[model samples]
Target: MATEAKKSGGIVETIKTVVYALLIAGIFRSLFFQPFWIPSGSMKDTLLIGDFLFVNKMTYGYSYASCPSIRIASLGINIDAKDICGIFDGDNKRLFGSEPERGDVVVFRHPVTGYDFIKRLIGLPGDRVQLKDGVVFINDEPVQLEDAGVFEEAAGPQGPQGLRPRCENGPVGDGGLCVKSRKIETLPGGVSHSILNISEQATDNTGIYTVPEGHFFFLGDNRDNSTDSRVPQAARGVGFVPYENLIGRADRIMFSSAGRSMFAFWTWRSDRYFKAIE
Candidate 1:
């Protein structure tokens, strides 16, 4: 009987240890980092579908966008689950960290949908932004662009079918899409990143837009395919994302897979493992 009791106590202790470990891991994930996997080709070429990565939670410090009031944060509560941002409703000064820089890949809450969306930061508060003939113009002058050649991609089971920005012209392999004209765009501070150019797309041109204070403008790397700041929120576009909506920057790709299931070891993208998001 005593041996059975001892065994039961050990099992209870093991369960408690696991529960404590999970709680600690939850706190670490909430405070230090956030793991996410790319589900769409929106940030493609830079972050492909199935690319798993971590967002530094502290990168922008504690903000209403991150959690509930700093008060609850101190109480060890989950901010996002509590809908603190929606309840408080306003701009929040970052408790720490720096502002988003040009050409940064940022993760943020979609203003209208509340869904987590990732895009490249383009215009800062008060910066003039425009797109003309498939080129991005900031402060009246076009951001520099140079030809970078083709970017090809195979469609995933989850990806939309047929020709898209990632697979612009036509078939690549058995069923892949390829873009023959990709351009490397250099931001003002010399931050360079590649952008796709589909001259036929309507978003390729736009009137000059002055970014409002306390907000930032964003664009997708797959320029012609993304519905970002250029689109209105009512129509499912992000529009001008408020400062409070800022989440964190994605720093690296932890892993990637090309298959439908994440556990499919045969579909692991070996080349993209541990790749940096540039």
Candidate 2:
């Protein structure tokens, strides 16, 4: 009976250790640091598809606290479910001394699908954003662009292995559509980044949009390829983004992989590591 009691005690200790380890990891991932995988080329040339990144959760204050899971009502009607989940035993307020700044790369929950998306903050609250003939303008000041040349041809399976090339690049039909690479010209107020223009003509044309109060205007670095605020209202195109939906700020690229190949972990581009976001 003595031996059996000792064995049971050891087993409980092991279980407690495992639970503590998992809880620590969960807290770190949800609050301070979280890993994100780039699933699309929408931010190409800056952030490639398959680029695994680490977003700094502390950059814009803790969003999970400010925006707790509360069921929102329409006008005066009560809703059944909450759209967001609050942190357990955590204060629902912005305690950290941080705020979203213009030109910062940010991650946020997509208003339409509730999925997370990463984009650069181009226009802040009450700022006017416009695009004309492929040129972006903020408050009537034109955003600059420079020629960065083309991408080097890399040989590989033309499409995902053993799959028909549906719609060109992938099943979503945006594969290889916009391949042109260009250097981004720095805009006024210290905003600068690269952009990819697939076609010579500006496909996304939108009139002046004044960012609403407590909202932001986001745009993908791959301007021509991204479905940003410039799209039509029916497709959930470019518009104001609520502040509560922000997840965090993207600070650095942790690792990058070529194409959609997962097993080719050895083929990760090591030269791009520790590079700062522009």
Candidate 3:
């Protein structure tokens, strides 16, 4: 027949141009943008552990887990695309965006393991927060550190080879996960971040947290190894994060890797691709 009907009409027009290019790339990643990956270092050196950012889902208004996976998981919608359009069913707000100051760097939907994490936005909904001995008071003032020094690392209990919550990576136990420390804060709008402390653990002397009403008080510029919100969602940490689990504002990075396999293309990191998440 006419050359097998012209190869079956060029295979049905190449499967309808790949289903119309996957529905225009799923409506351009569910409207506006979203691409995150920095497996974990808890925002180290401002985000490293193989950084790879983008998130800016209209800057703050798109929830329904605003594209983390955009939900549908067997009806539970796990993996950070949390509560799918129901926004946890109480109308958790944030439908038009804006409001998330302090130091920014966020990426949420993790009100207690909904899973997108990524911190930095210290207290805002009623402030009063504290840390005293390790410094970081708000509403009472102390929010301006200096000593930008040590922050070394390398003594694995599993990290750097893939970097993750791997045993919570700290100068923890068995003498292997090395880390040195010092100050480097500066958030009152000026930004200036950096913090580590290999010494005074246990959330570095907390106690006086207030911050309620709409909730939000994150942290994890690696201050003594983060669990966030001063660790307390029944102890799994990252508590007090509502405002409907706000999920955006990571700004830029776009690519990096020390490769434990993201195809391992020569362990990438190529000058940290398009850097700029500060």
Candidate 4:
């Protein structure tokens, strides 16, 4: 009887340890840094699919969007940040918030869908932004772009999503080289980054979009492939994201994998480990 009682107490203690660990992890994720996995090529050479980074939550302070959204399909555990922290939402204000600078890579919640999206901040509130012939213009001044050669990757399926990359030199067979034109885009205030181009698309040329006050305009580095501020939310694009929807800034990549599973040691991208995000 005593042996059974000891075993029961041990089990209870183990359960308590697990619960405490979970609570600590939850608090850590909610307040300081949130893990973000790059699932798409929208950011391209700047941030490839399978790049894992921690969003610096404190950079923009706290808001309802800063709360982590947990989704485990296998476990059927789907929890949105709104479900946990919705009580703190609706004001469109952030606590101890700081303004995000242009050219900074950010992760924010989609205003309508509540899903997270990462993009480079291209336009601030009240900025006039436009794209003409695949070039970005801020307040009618064209941004500086210099050809940076071409970016190439395998034509086969990439990452866990098995998504094929759209290439400028397409019609590539599996295991062949998929290529896109690369350029060094220098935004206003001297922030420069790499941008990829496949070809001229409808989004390449657009009328001036006057970003409304209290909202920001963002665009992906992969200009031709992104569905960003150029398209409206109604059209399934991430329209001018609200200030409160901003979650955090992504500073550096923590880990990266090119395979279907992160645990595939052979597929780990050693060069990308602890790499800084530009």
The most accurate candidate by TM-score is: 4
Q: Order the numbered candidates by TM-score, best leading.
A: 4, 1, 2, 3
lDDT of 1 by residue, 1-278 (tens): 99999999999999999999988976776678877778777776788777889988787775656652222455685435237445545644666757888888998888876678999999999999999888889999899999888776654355223223345665445556655467888999999888875547788888887999888999998787788999878888999988777778899998887776567768888898889998
Candidate 2 vs candidate 3: which has greater lDDT? Answer: 3
How far in Å is the alpha carbon of 154 misplaced in model 4? 0.9
Cα-based lDDT at residue 235, candidate 3: 78
Tens digits of per-residue lDDT for model 4 on 71-164? 8999999999999999989888899999999999999999889989999999999899999999999998999999999999999888888999
Winner by TM-score between candidate 4 and candidate 1? 4
Best model number under lDDT: 4
Q: TM-score for model 2? A: 0.78
Q: Write the per-residue lDDT of candidate 2 for residues 171-235, one digit (tens) a residue.
A: 33323442355766576786778776655445556789888777788888777667666664467
Winner of 1 and 3 under TM-score: 1
Measured against the true structure, the TM-scores of the candidates, in listed sequence, are 0.85, 0.78, 0.36, 0.98
Worst 10 residues of 4 by lDDT: 259-268
Enumerate residue pairs that collide in model 4: none
RMSD of each: 5.1, 6.9, 14.5, 0.9
Residues 1-278 of candidate 3: C-alpha lDDT, one tens digit per residue:
99999999999999999999998886787667767777777667677676767778777776576754544566885444543455443566766867888888888867755777788888999888889778888988988888876655454433345443323334354435555565778877788777665556657788888888877899888776677888779978877887767777887887776656555668777887787877
184: Cα error in model 3, Å: 17
Count of backbone collisions in candidate 1: 1
CA lDDT, every model vs. true structure: 0.77, 0.66, 0.73, 0.93
Q: What is the lDDT of residue 174 in candidate 2?
A: 29
